[model samples]
Target chain A: MSLPELLRKISPTIWELPVTYKEGMRVPARIIASESLIGGMEAGVFDQAANVACLPGIIDYAWCMPDGHWGYGFPIGGVAAFDPDSGVISPGGIGFDINCGMRLCLTNLTEDEVRPRIRELVDQLFFAIPTGVGCTGFVRCSRSTFRRVIENGSRWCLENGYALPEDLEMTEEGGRFEGADADACSDKAVERGFDQIGTLGSGNHYCEIQVARPENIFDAATARAFGITIPNQVVIMFHCGSRGFGHQVATDYLQTFLKVMTTKYGIKLYDRELACAPFRSPEGQAYFAAMKCAANMGFANRQVILHRIREVFSRLFHRSPRDLGMDMVYDVAHNTAKLEKHIVHGVERELLVHRKGATRAFGPGMTGLPDRYRDSGQPVIIGGSMETGSYLLAGEASAAPTFYTTAHGSGRTLSRHQAKKMVQGRKLLDDMERRGIHVRTDSYGGLAEEAGLAYKDIDVVTRVTEDAGLSRRVAKLVPMGNIKG
Target chain B: MPYRFQDEITTADVAFEAWGDTREELFISCATALLRTMTAAPEQVAHEQKRVIRLKHEELDLLLFSFLQELIFHKDAHRLLLHADSVRIEQRESIFKLVATVSGEPIDAARHRLLVDVKAVTLHRFQVLFRDNQWRAVVELDV
Candidate 1:
């Protein structure tokens, strides 16, 4: 059956596919999107979602967030929870760019203070941070040091003076996954990560400067709690991932899983990319351990980049970061299979929740949140394309139905080739400049591929999210400067 | 006819098709396609740099995957612009082994107008098939 015929709309924002819709499906599939968005979604979105529901030990349902799109195995913005005892773990479900995530920083400066210096700031940021493919960061370490980085995560950065003590408090999992075993990582993975500890690898990865527009503040109290009380408050946001280290880790484990998934575990996969092993098996455990290493590397990578951002601000303004009130708001991972305990069937159970292209949106008072944000839910940083606006949202109790996960970003709606065909980088650059947005990119062609038209409308996505009660909007940020890799 | 590669598929990521008269030629065409994704042509790269990639896999599909992954690894780890100049693939007792010499140079902004950085190769709809005396492969790169 076709996607529209296969899907049954339960609510205006939620659609359902009965388990009987597909022969192998063990549970029903849920797609969270408005009618318009669903109409525009590719058929692969539901196909992949149904494929995930068929996986063994999946609890309740496999959910696709509002921004769901076609992905390799799990649909981008897909969320699934597998029983630790009976379920399986698929690397493709966690995505190749492990811990590809968002980090937001609150600054004391306002839009006025940054507007005049936008060009200079972007240039400085572009120069200070490496971009493009194979670009190296400032943190070059020996193989041993690289091992330490993977094992310790942001703690390594703190010990090495790249991070502050409080940074971990606002970061997910304290920026470290406890079970990370560097030895589980392959030599090639380590070699790729050794020199790229803090670099911003290319292709949609970026560092952006934004301002919290007064008119866009949805919840003043929540905005104040997030350090955005003043209208036009400047903020810094960056999007990056684990770089080659995580890519290699996912690649290496995928190959290993494909080799033994059938013979060792009696598992059959509809897609080769969904190759997996039982969570308790050696292969599964080893991949988890290595995945944790990559996860930690991702945290450390962002931590170092955060430090560089602070440095740029400090140097440019001739003021210490502390004096400038440059503080971290939050850092969240969008791609991960985190071991979390959530109530399943009204029974509390520990399940491995795989959120690919989706962010964990733990509701108010959820464990792991920093003390300052105990009253409010964890901050959800949703980045938009360079030409659009982004958002800072707080988790809602309504997200429990989907394991407390929400859309990670305004999901891409166009292919790079299609985007390039519709827009030219030179014209885009000029347009952004005319709109008072400064952008610095290493490749003009890359810039064209990331044109704002390439992504779903962020406003619509975030509105659907809030209306669906998955998350509550806190503030909206408009870009003033952007640095793309 | 020499193998040819084309970027004709449209998805959120990059996808391309490569075809050749033989598997070896298909592998070469695939490598060229992977490199061309980062830049327009091989002529834009210099031959001052060299990277030797070797891998052994039990399946031909996997061998191609590893071969492309090796090129990406070199690009990320060493900033090399690779163009596989020579490729040799042989099967020994059901094991497919590939060794290739790639010539390139460090990425120079003045010469190399880079494109999207390919993070890894995805197996989504990935295929290598022989049809009507011609070999063809479809690959999607996670950029």
Candidate 2:
């Protein structure tokens, strides 16, 4: 049967596949998307989400967000909360790049002030921030220091003059995950990631200069609260994670889990990528600690990248980052499995919420949000393709349906190969320039692969999230300049 | 000629199918495909450095997975863009062991038109099959 035929519509935006839809399902699988979005989804997405429902101790519903697409094991935008005692922790639920996320920094400069110099800004950024495959970072540190950096995350950046105190407050988990032990990480993982702190790795990762036009501000009061008050304000937003370090961590644990998941734990999986161990087992605890280390490394990687952005802007604009009002609005990780307290069936329980390619949209008054955002809710940054615009959103109280999680980005609609066949990289560069968006990339082939047409409509994604009551749109950000790796 | 990219199999990452007359040739074909994913032109990577790798696994497919992961490790840890020069796989009882010689140089951005980084090989639909008297494997990379 077709996915649409098997799924029962719960609402205009919510669709559910009953547990009977597939064997071994622990609970129903839900997809939160508009009809149009749901209709366009590939069968692999539904199959993957259903596969997730079959995992041990998955509570409530297995969810696929508006940006859902087929991933290796769990669908991109997959979310599920697993019980600590009865559940399992799978690397596939967290992704290869631990804490791979979005960071938005607000600036006082207007498009008029930055547009004329867009080429220079992009060029300087491309130079200052090492990008592409096998790129090393600018931060020089010993292995011992690197251990501390991974353990302490953005806190190390603060002490080393790369981050301000306020930046930590604005970052998720105050820029560090507790219980991160460097000992839990493999030396191979450490070696692979230690030198990648300030570098942006290749493939769909970017740093963009975007403008918030007066017309695109959807909620002016909330936007003002998030420090996006200026009309035509140019903000710097970047997407990356812990580079090679996180990849190695996930890779190591994946193999370890695969070896023991069935023989040692008797856990059966629909896919090998979904291999997992009992959450309370020795293997699982060690992986949790190691994953936390990678998460911290991701935080530090972006922190250092933020420092470079500050340095370049200060040098070019002849003003300190602080003087230019270049304060971070927020940094959020989409790929993570974090423990949080949530009310399930009228009982408050601590559950490990795994949000892969999904954002935590904690509503107003929810715990973990900073006091400054206590009333307005957490800021949710949904990055779009370079040609299309991105959105700034706020969590809504109405997100209780999906554990306060929402879509990450305008998810891909085409494969990279398919995208490359549609547009030439040189032509894309020239076209973007002609359209007033300056771009600098490490490889044109890579650039062509990320052509905007490769992704779903960002506007539609934002509308679906809002309509589904997962998040509310605050402002739309149009790119002025971009640096792609 | 031994490998081709399977564009339709994955959306966010890259996938390919490789075949060989023997398991050794299959490993080399898979290595070549992995190298091509990271660089538009893998032949441009000079064989200035050489590394020998030996690994054993109880399963044939996992042996292939470990072999590819070793290449990714060198790329991440040492920034080397390597390709397998020769591979030999032997089975003893239920265990499969692989020994290979790989060669490449540290990636020079000026010399190589690098593509996206292949983060890790995925076990999703990962396979090593002996079909039609030829050894074949299907692999997907998390980019």
Q: Which candidate tops TM-score? A: 2
Clashing pairs in 2: none
For candidate 2, the docking band is high
Off by over 4 Å in 2: A1-4
> Tens digits of per-residue lDDT for model 1 on A79-100?
9999989999999899999999
Candidate 1 ranges with C-alpha deviation above 4 Å: B1-10
lDDT score of residue A204 within candidate 2: 91
Task: Give the CA lDDT, 0 to 100, for residue A443 in model 2.
Answer: 89
Worst 10 residues of 2 chain B by lDDT: B108-117
Second chain of candidate 2: TM-score?
0.98
RMSD of 1: 1.5
C-alpha TM-scores of all predictions: 0.98, 0.99
lDDT of 2 by residue, A27-110 (tens): 999999887898889888988999999999899999999999988989999999999999999999999989999999999999
